[model samples]
Target: MSTDAERLGWAEQAAEALTEAGYRRGGVRSAIVALLDEQSCALSAVEIGEALAERGRRASRASVYRVMEELERIGLLARVEVGQGIVRYEPLREGPGHHHHLVCERCGRLEPFTDDGVERAIQRLSERLPLEVSEHEIVIRGACRSCAD
Candidate 1:
């Protein structure tokens, strides 16, 4: 979980980005961005709507999806497909410091991890290949410790 201050900072940054992109900072969008900022893992659109409702922030499913898509368009969110047709969204970090996911196939648990060696290897591969790699996502699927136990 992120500290309250950290989450607030993220929300502020997202609002600034939205404003700069010529979008108004409406109530629903603000709530959705705040929710995404506080989350440590990706969430589906339905999940996001439910969460907002739980907090007394009512928003229609369509509105939620639209706002999510806008956030993704502005690079504030990343859409992750962990398989089984389940699409999830998570906040994108500021720059190249973004992490990848380790998903537990059995329990559907998602964990974020970062490794300098993996980043270096990707850079080396990019250099060796003719294609210029702008970004990458690694999703390692296996049983988690609890599921294995």
Candidate 2:
């Protein structure tokens, strides 16, 4: 969603969003958010820390990890394991901030999109599971249409 404050990028929006969700934010949190946006990829905690350092914005490894864990616990971020020991965090929200991703493994491209079939599937699943699924994101990683050539 486009909030006047949300324009500051994922790191800034994350701090605001988390605070609205009842988490007290600090530099580490902001740094983590920026790192996520800069890398624009699903990254492990260590990778995140390293990236921050490379950008001349250093955050303690422990703190970086803690923020990642806390975000997940607070339901603001989702931990996805796309490969061996590789976990990354992604924000989830409906309305304007909602969508899924198509990750190109070969090209390292992340494409965001939403589809009706996904919505229908979630509705179907909620009926069978008896739990309210607010939103769902599917990361389909493979060759893109052009890459299929």
Candidate 3:
């Protein structure tokens, strides 16, 4: 998990990058960035719009998707798909953003997980492989604790 400070730092960096990329600052974009900063898990464009509305910040779903697409293009956001045609977005930080997902196929609950052993194994595998691995994501699907009953 990322600390509030880290998330805020990333949000600032994202806003700067967008500015540098010539994306004019607007209410929707700024609101989206602020909303994303508070999230520990990925959210879909629809969810983002809903969240903004719930917070008294109005943002159109189309605008949310446009901003998300721009962020993804700039490498500030990562796309997460946990099956069932559901796609979500999360910030891509330098360190803590790197982790895998624990998906509950039964309830569609998604959670983040990290392990030093998994990281070491990936490093070893990368050392053995011929190609360069820029990134990787592992999604383990099973019933979450609640659904296990």
Candidate 4:
């Protein structure tokens, strides 16, 4: 879990980036970014709106989706598909360092994981291939412990 200070720092950095990109920082946009920054897993637009409502913040579903799209445009968010045609959004970390997801197909659970071996393999593959791989995401789908039982 991220400390409140860390979450605030992320939100501040996002605000600065948005302002630098000639975008006005509004309540809905800020809230959406803050929520994404504090999250460890991706969330759908519907989930985002529900979370905001739980926190006493209100935004139309369309507005939330639009803000998410804008955030993605600014390189602050990435769209990840766990499975089952569900599109989710997560915060994009800086530079080439990022993690992958382990998704439970039976229960729609997403878990973030990092592995040095996988990273090295990806780097090697990128070197051997014609394309330069700056970033990558690998989603492994299976059943969770509970679901498998």
Please provide, for model 4 over 22-50, each residue's C-alpha lDDT reduced to its tens digit, 9 standing for 90 to 100: 88987899889878877877899999999
Candidate 1 segments whose C-alpha is farther than 4 A from its true place? 1-9, 94-97, 105-107, 123-134, 143-149
Residue-level lDDT of model 1, residues 1-149, one tens digit each, is 45677667777889999999999987899899888887877899989999999999999999998999899998888787766777789887634336888888887777888888998898889999888866778899999999999
lDDT of every model, 2 decimals = 0.84, 0.68, 0.84, 0.82
* Per-model TM values vs. the true structure: 0.77, 0.62, 0.85, 0.81
Worst 10 residues of 2 by lDDT: 1-10
What is candidate 2's local distance difference test score?
A: 0.68
Error of 2 at 37 (Å): 5.9
For residues 1-149, what per-residue lDDT tens digits would candidate 3 score against the true structure?
A: 67777888988998899999999886888888888888877898879989989889887777788888999998888888867888888887557757778988887788988888998898899988998977777888899999999
Tens-digit lDDT string for candidate 2 (36-122): 655433577877888788878888878888888877876667666554446666664555555677776665555667787887788
Off by over 4 Å in 2: 1-24, 34-41, 101-113, 124-129, 139-149
Query: What overall lDDT, based on C-alpha atoms, would model 3 receive against the true structure?
Result: 0.84
Which candidate comes out best when scored by TM-score?
Answer: 3
> RMSD in angstroms, all models?
3.0, 4.4, 2.0, 2.8
